[model samples]
Target: MNITDLMWKNATAYGYTFTRTPPDAACAARVTLLEWLDAGRINPAVARVFPLEQAAEAQRHLIEDRPFGRVLLTLAR
Candidate 1:
């Protein structure tokens, strides 16, 4: 199936479940992520840390759909 067909199927199956977010909703999402991180609700097993210099490489890995969880860039030590 093509992109449009996939999107229509998803929409029909999960009516109104996907939509653009307002500014406030975006802020709320950021806050929720921060809270989850602070509360240690996010599992380390699902996280990958990389140095700033390797950010491009990280993006390539993600775009290629390499195996892993969240990819993060960190400051140099």
Candidate 2:
């Protein structure tokens, strides 16, 4: 399926607008998105963190719906 079809499917399933097309004003939109993120207005739940090497395992956990929030992959410094 193409991007449009995929978007339609998702929108129908979730009852929301899913756009396959890119925004015409991406630069301005990106600035807005960044501002929201920095302002804590777009905070996402963090379920768990794993080392980069365990990313695959984390994905599996997410796929199984074991995580309650977003899973993050961290790199050891």
Candidate 3:
């Protein structure tokens, strides 16, 4: 909220350089992410999976239950 919190405390104090990059960088980052996924390097922790039909239930679970990790909604039958 404050300048100290935004710049010094959150960024500089932690030794992290917060910066903004060009929009094209996002596309390149996505490509890199896909490459990592293909190489089986990115293993996301899945909490639970819900079918598309159970979208409401999934949302409710997310809002109320708040399970750890990702709650995936799949369209596959």
Candidate 4:
């Protein structure tokens, strides 16, 4: 899908909050990554998501479990 469509879909599906920060190195990198995602050039692997309050547990899981993919932390809405 195109960048506009991908961004709209993700914003609606994931409750994304778009920001209008000034351009910098990080912003450029983020834009590039979003473009790559929009183009389906890369697939992110997620191991598991832990609630924000369970950060210690998540860290333990990372150290002990050694998961093959990323361990994410999500905020409660």
Best of the candidates, lDDT? 4
Name the TM-score of candidate 1: 0.51
Tens digit per residue, CA lDDT, model 3, 4-77: 77665465433322246566886687788789989999886788999999999999999999887899999985
User: Candidate 4 lDDT, tens digit per residue, 7-75?
Assistant: 877754343333655558557878988999899997788899999999999999999999878999999
What TM-score would every model get versus the actual structure? 0.51, 0.53, 0.65, 0.57
Number of the top TM-score candidate: 3
TM-score of 4: 0.57
- Candidate 1 ranges beyond 4 A from true positions: 1-19, 44-47, 63-65
Model 4, residue 39: C-alpha shift (Å):
5.7
Query: Which pairs of residues collide in candidate 4?
Result: none
Worst 10 residues of 4 by lDDT: 12-21
TM-score of 3: 0.65
Task: Name the candidate, 1 or 2, with the larger TM-score value.
Answer: 2
> How many Å off is the CA of 46 in candidate 3?
1.5
Model 3 steric clash pairs: none
* C-alpha RMSD in Å of predicted model 4 compared with the true structure: 13.2
